[model samples]
Target: MSEETPVLSLPLIQPSQAQKHVTHNEALMRLDALVQAVVLTRDSISPPSDPDAGECHIVPSAATGVWSGQDHALAYFDGTAWQFLAARPGWRVYVLSDLQTVFWDGSAWTGETASFQNLNGVGIGTNSDSTNRLAVSSEASLLSHDGAGHQLKINKSAAADTASLLFQTGWSGRAEMGTAGDDAFAIKVSADGAAWHTALSFDPGTGLATGDAVQTSATDTSAGRLMRADFGYGPGNVLGAVSESAGVPTGAVIERASTVNGDYIRFADGTQICQFNASLSYISAGLCSAVWTFPAGFVSGSTPQVQGTLNSDSLAASAPSVTVAGLTGMTISGLGATSVTLNVNALASASFGSGESVDLGVLAIGRWY
Candidate 1:
């Protein structure tokens, strides 16, 4: 009836009451070895040849020697013999040999590091919650480094597989940049996820960029060239004139006729303009005539202005009333969009005499858009 009696089982009465202390002391010794005991091993059937006192082990099936027929029992070495304690569910034991914590779960003992199920959150060196399921709030995070320069790779199943990092808004993709379906590095954007536009791409083989209608190779057919800004300027500032270069000239002024389809390059000073020029020769047995065709066709609804000087090779004794007849002898008899005609004769006299040749230096001013 004393407190030294076993909690679960009472010792049998011996022949003498004086030896009750022996039974009580034995039960207390077993309780001291089993309570909060650290076992050296589990499922060990064979007894150690040299077990230290107070060392414990979980009895295995078909155990031999003192542990025989005591499977799943906590066995303790009390230096003289083995003491057994029945294991129940939720009993925990620390294995000193393996430095692991193990517990009995109704059926069997399992290690603490084994896989778990239905965990809400897990944190390493911190506490986690439902929002952050697996949070590791640390200064730096590392992955797959085994003592050398390491590369973090995101591999796909095949060559035509898409492997990219997509930035999303509300779980919808906005932009993606990576090797999507190819080896070339590409950056693509999308307003809606269904249709995507490639903004830029860099070819790994050629080291060239292709986008924005810019040519990537020197042998391309189009006459496209790179344009670079001279410098940055403030807003609302007027740009200076650019000199003529391999491309179109900057600060160029153009003028179109009001009544015609003629466009011309008009300069700032208006001193020089683009014009058509021609020289005509005429044989004079009567009124000499010649026609000039424009090199570039003139614009419709425009009449070209013609001016010239005429030279006559004839001087005769029977000269006309006007001795100097050549200066005032030429006239623009006809004019059209594409051609002009000039008439040459002796001024206020008969037609130019036989064997006289007339030369006219003519100029036409007009526009052909």
Candidate 2:
């Protein structure tokens, strides 16, 4: 017999040897449809009323008509009637309705593809070279969008669960950022992965940022301030200080000798306290008093303490009775806002001669505003 003709393991019986080929041909017709078979549908249990010739189906259990009692058998439609073939293990068939190839695995049909394991790389839409494994090249790749807006959530199992993205250098962790524990977002960096510094953190509950050297508030109320600039001792410096100009300190507070000939303490709020010393020389002999101008922003009615030393040997050795010249008996006698008068009675009861001078040192303490 030719390859197209099916050879059956059956005795050929014929009346007068005429109908022998008829039965052989009938068996061959069934084999033609069953070999390398394809099925239009697999889910329908009921046989169609008008199945065309060579059309086949997997006969479901309790099927009616010619398909009855032939569950899971290949039922092929010959030109005249239906024919059944028992399916064996590894019987492969293409299911046209599902557009997939299924195979019988001794008991049931499965659609699993052949095994592919331990590949060096696999690329979709692009060529995969040796450097990558399972590379998918696309303009963009989206994930987990079933319906509405989607969120790619990296969730942890508990409050102490670490869900973070770690950046590495030569397989050693350099930095990491995410929710390491609890719901707070944190960013940490490390020279070595074992010791990490939390550089920044954000609290979800309070909406505040906090960390080792970072803060997000104006005041320190358990939380720290927003900004803090620090300086450390540099070359030849006794202490750390910040300066906007070379050799000049322009910080919130500065203590320095004034270039305009005085000593001053200045605050960030524009308040200054100054002290100075001066020599009051007499214009002529018999001079007993002199008025000194007060520093700017001096408070009226506030007495400035004054002490003096005689510039010449013009009086007896005794402390002069010093007072504000206008206000009798008061050391800071004429206590005006801008100036004050000093009455210096040398020798206890007498005045000094011409060209006599007194070196006066005054300290006025008050606020600017």
Candidate 3:
């Protein structure tokens, strides 16, 4: 105080303010006092307690905590009141406060009675060996686990009929409706229950009626479970029109399509068997000049068997007459002789003789598919 200045000689400072030099000196002295009193305060401060030595009441779980004891010897305060947490090993109990206890029957903590007092949802239990588990409540759902996946049951109510189970197997069967007295048919198949391939197709009006057994192929029989069945009508408005053609090709009848002259006959088979040209001048009268014998043992059916052309031996012929053969498989059963002649229309005056020559044309055959 003797070395300091007078209180009235200071510059205009606030009433609650102190001088900077005085404040600095006061802080230094306090620091020095504190350093000098550290030894005395050392005895006053006790050593820090060990953190991991007691029955931990509020321990944060790094892993699961195992509670095992026989008689009620331990107590814990769960931020509220002191209560006994567990008792003995085969006989266990947890005092969860307010006269409530959680009892365990060698397995899990269960209520003495089904008390809905603090129950949030439902209760679950396991069998004696704990291999199977069951859950109980007023309205219960199911859950199954096989260490691979988990499934849950959901209760739903609707006016419409919906899909109950959506399980995918190797195969599925379906019955598609058609016209009354129509046949049932198989439509498609699937391998993994997604992509489908058509297995069988039926013609319109070719389906089996209701209650009829559907016939399957050897391929379908072997691939039993991995197959599927469906039914549909034929394309367009036609019903069951499935008709399979013969496996073999059959010969059809040929009709006359074109002609060069009336004398020459052309058939639809594309075979130009005969020709009518302005050659071999004959008498200008259309007549059978001479009587020639007709061939014996000639028969006709669906097809022509023996084809022959009669050369007008009586006169020079102008046009060649054509005859188609019969069915190839048919045999000439009873023939009178090898040389059978027929009547011809030609120049009978002086240019020709009787029964000169005859020729057979290309023979046609029948084929079956």
Candidate 4:
């Protein structure tokens, strides 16, 4: 009942039509132009001055000249003039100039991309080289995940090879981190890319670290090195060693250890004290004397500060001096580095002074080392 097809609007011949060949030929012309449609371009707004017969293009927006008011329509040229055909939603056409296939989605033409499941290389805006197969010249790149999490992993086949991320400045490596060599986790840096210095490294087997950042030796007093407990002094072994260098002690910060030398106690700081108790016998009615041998402290031929105290209870006399008794103090004489002599003279109650005996305590302080 209608004059043309509903979808393509091609002229339809009706029964009893006078010139059926004219209408049928017109339908055939429409088929020749639209089927397997191919176009020179999809973005040109101006009609070509010398378009050949059967030359086609998708008229762009703001079209001028003969293509005016035919935006987004397929413009096909016949031998005589140009014809504008309304496009459907799913019409696909190959664009020769862009070397791509595009589809009509009602308003404009969009690229018709094929599946890229197993492409050998994909260079977005640059040429793909053999080594860098998927090269892209971009300001930034993003590899995000579908929803939750994402990870970018790099792997290597052998331990001797590197698997790491390198940071660079001006295409020269400045730092690198990860397992670099021999299965060890390492962080290395370089001012110049050729020579690398390991700032931090971890041994995979023992989990111990070794690098310029760690302090592994005992005598490392340099700056910017971490002090290890076993390799340096700490609370457990504060008195690590004893050395007086440049008239200043280098080790043993406090008094935690001491050396015993017979009656002498020697300290790590070079201080020694000699403490002893002695018994004296009277040689005369008012005199008593005792010989003392020095302990191992107090360097040879050194005089030390000496002090003595007598046991007061022993000075009492049973003779009672016929009523009460008294005695004078003691004296130190014949002093030497290794020995000393002490004498006590008692003048009170001479009758009871003879054979008098008493106990004495002595102390001496000096340096040992």
Local accuracy by lDDT, each model: 0.63, 0.61, 0.29, 0.76
Candidate 1's residue-wise lDDT over 1-369, tens digit each? 444334434354466578788777677667676577689888678988888888889887888987888888888887788878777677788988778988888777788876667788889889888876776869987787689778867788876898888887887999999899898888888898878877778898986767543444423335543321222122322233322233333333333221131222333222112233333333554555667665445567677676766433333332232245443556886687777777665654445554444555566676443
Poorly placed runs, candidate 3 (over 4 Å): 1-72, 77-301, 304-369
Q: For residues 213-302, what per-residue lDDT tens digits would candidate 2 score against the true structure?
A: 563332333444344332222233332222333423344344334433345554433344656554555533334466666445444445
| TM-score for each predicted model, relative to the true structure | 0.37, 0.43, 0.19, 0.46
lDDT of 1: 0.63
RMSD of each: 15.2, 14.8, 24.4, 10.2
Which runs of model 4 end up more than 4 angstroms from their true locations? Answer: 1-118, 143-147, 232-369
Clashing pairs in 4: none
Model 3 — TM-score against the truth? 0.19
Give the candidate number with the greatest TM-score: 4
Candidate 4, residue 316: Cα displacement in angstroms equals: 15
Candidate 1's C-alpha runs over 4 A off are 1-16, 113-369
Count of clashes, each model: 0, 4, 26, 0
Clashing pairs in 2: 284-354, 285-353, 285-354, 324-333
